[model samples]
Target: MGRRKSQRKNVAMLDSDEDNSSVSSSSTARSDLMSVSGAGDVQVDKDSLLEQALDALYEKRGSTREKALAAIIEAFNTNLRHQFVEKKFATLLHQCLNSIKKGSSKEIALGCHAIGLLALTVGSGDHAREILEESVAPISHALKSSSDSLKTVSLLECLAVVTFVSATETEETERSMQIMWQLLHPKLGSNVVAVKTPAVVVTAVVSTWAFLLTTMDGCSLNSKDWQESISYFSTLLDKDERSVRISAGEALAVIFETGIEKLAAENKTTPDGSILEGNKYRQGYTHILGLKSKILNQVRSLSAEAGGKGSTKKDLNSQRNLFKDVLEFLEDGYIPDISMKIGGNSLHMSTWSELIQLNFLKHFLGGGFVKHMQDNELLHDVFGFTPKRKNILGVEHQMTSGEKRMFQSPNSVLNKARTQFLNKQRMLSKDRNVGHFAFGMGDEDSR
Candidate 1:
């Protein structure tokens, strides 16, 4: 009876069958799993399970493929699985790609997410570049063919993350951003009718685009191409959906912070594809400056916006705070210096780019955020965070903040999974303020 109970509990923790879009494990459930699997054999048991899941990916049944993919995602999320990735990265990546090619919607979603996690786990190297090179074509194909909202969201996120980590060139990032934008504003030929994108999907595309935008040099982007982007996002400010507005607001923040003067000077092309020189170039700069002024006014209004008929207090607060920061950036040329308390030390994000990357990865990693931030070397480099060092007297040394968070007691499973899981739930269920790291906002001068 106890074994069956454990099995049931594991299923509940790993399988979000009802949602089919999320795979999360509770630390308590993981602790239960550790007890049943035996503490000493945890690594061995997890390896066996991963091997089984990888093989199961080849089974002909769609449900079987989906379950296998889910199990792989859960395993990857629960731990870094560095050894498994090092040995079988190629095989694992190919199987996930095959699932994207042949499996059902859920399978495709899982495969996209699994490949993303794989890229992140591999970090920035030849392996990460390989994941980007191999996965982009299949992900692009899946996006064009499938209209499933859940699948589209996953594909967009995977594209953003893979490109962010692996694409080393400015052109590569631009290409990925173009693909994401196509979902929202497809080029309609003759009889091609545009598909009305769901508000949720719009939110994902805009936010993911902004995430990749953080990586590019503003001067490298074509002025003619991006000139209208500010206007487009300005229109999004009037969107009824709070999420969409929030995403547009964030995107605007990134755009304004990217140094528009440099972008304006890059404007050489006219709308007719002819080169702009002398007066035309100067006109382009002035036009961009005008757009900046218009946006500043819009942001000022949003910062002081009062609650409407059905606006929840929490969401209203989020919008007000975000816009206030944006307004401050526009007027005074000051970005918000936000600090998040992680254990004993605090993680600081003083730039728009840093904050966007942090929020995207926090959502992408979900419960695994704390674990990866603690152990993932790439993240450490990205955030410039250094974990506490241990001395030669390691046996007598006390545990660091990350270790204590992971293991409440010796021989016990990590506890951060539970805390981060609740935080993720709150983030998804309600647009609550950023938490878990005790995220708070402050002024640059104050810092």
Candidate 2:
């Protein structure tokens, strides 16, 4: 009777173990079903009732993760209202960015694009700063991802967000500027997909820099930094990629405009109360002027080489287009300050004259293009008298003896004549119909 009782206890224990196993298996099945249902809810077909649900979520201004994603998609769609979409999307963007700290890679990338769309939209407001700060780690990680598309999208989105943030006048703008400056270095700017990225990012960066330098509020970038920016852009101009070249040209135009303004401002200011009182600033102005000349020369050399044989016509066209852009920039009242001051100095006169002559030649070659430099008075000052130098390929080649002598004295009559010549040439060039005698061939051959 003792052995039988022990066997019965053992059988009872086995039955209890089977019952517990059945309960555990049932619990696992319920858990799996719940997980599947949750996944199914999130994974709606692109063209099903799910789209309607997403639309409804966006319409209702839902702040849940699903709603935020739907709003982002709506912003990216081509058929949205500019103002309404931007405002609603910005609201969702803030919520999404706040969650990015704990989000997955896909989540972060989606957030980045949402911010990018906000940047593209007008009236993004102060939210750009918040997005930029929150995106730093995620963007950096995305940039390092093994997937090329992820890296490209991350770069473009980061560029847009930072650009919008830097445009504002708040103290937080500096953070965005710093991030942009770091990204613009050779390591990042020269990224493998630099060619394939959208032009908006490059354009935004250039515009932001221009605004910063021209305005008093933004941090002053050093000359070396500025030079590096130019160098990187210059390299981009030489890239085999067409879009990159076009974007580089646009950026260069902005830089040239700002540089011209800075140069003019420096030239006008004096240590004394009087504008006529020449001060130490002249040396600084002269150095800047030299730098400008160097940059222009480099551009000219690049343009020439890029336009040579074996190059595609499209490539040559781009180089010519860049040259035209530079000319247009210089024409926009840049040299007037110096021109007015040195009107009585022969060397100054000669220099202005040469610049005018080059402008005329370029205009003639660039399909009847006329720049702002070709105003009436500037034309007379440039071409009123005999050219000091003989015309070479429609450009004045050398200064004459009288011009050279005037260049020696600060207030010589020849200097005055030189200025008058420049003013006349400017006027003549202004009249697009006026034929450049220097460039015109004799009619004897036609007869």
Q: Residue 369 deviation, candidate 1, in Å? A: 0.3
TM-score of each: 0.77, 0.43
- As for candidate 1, its clashing pairs are none
**At residue 214, what lDDT does model 2 achieve?**
26
RMSD of candidate 2 to the truth, in angstroms, is 30.0
Which 10-residue window of candidate 2 scores lowest in summed lDDT? 1-10
Supply the global lDDT for candidate 2: 0.39
Worst 10 residues of 1 by lDDT: 1-10
Question: Candidate 1, 120: how far from true, in Å?
Answer: 0.6
- Candidate 1 local Cα displacement, residue 84, angstroms: 0.3
- Model 2 residue 24 CA deviation in Å: 52
User: Once superposed on the true structure, which residue ranges of model 1 sit more than 4 Å away at CA?
Assistant: 1-43, 264-278, 389-447
Native-to-model Cα distance after best TM-score fit, residue 351 in candidate 2, in Å = 26
Tens-place lDDT per residue, model 1, 230-308, is: 8788888988888898999999877755536455444556557677776556565556666765677777788888878
- Give candidate 2 misplaced runs (Cα > 4 Å): 1-75, 81-91, 94-110, 119-153, 156-158, 165-167, 170-174, 184-245, 268-284, 301-316, 331-447
**What is residue 111's positional error in candidate 2, in angstroms?**
3.7
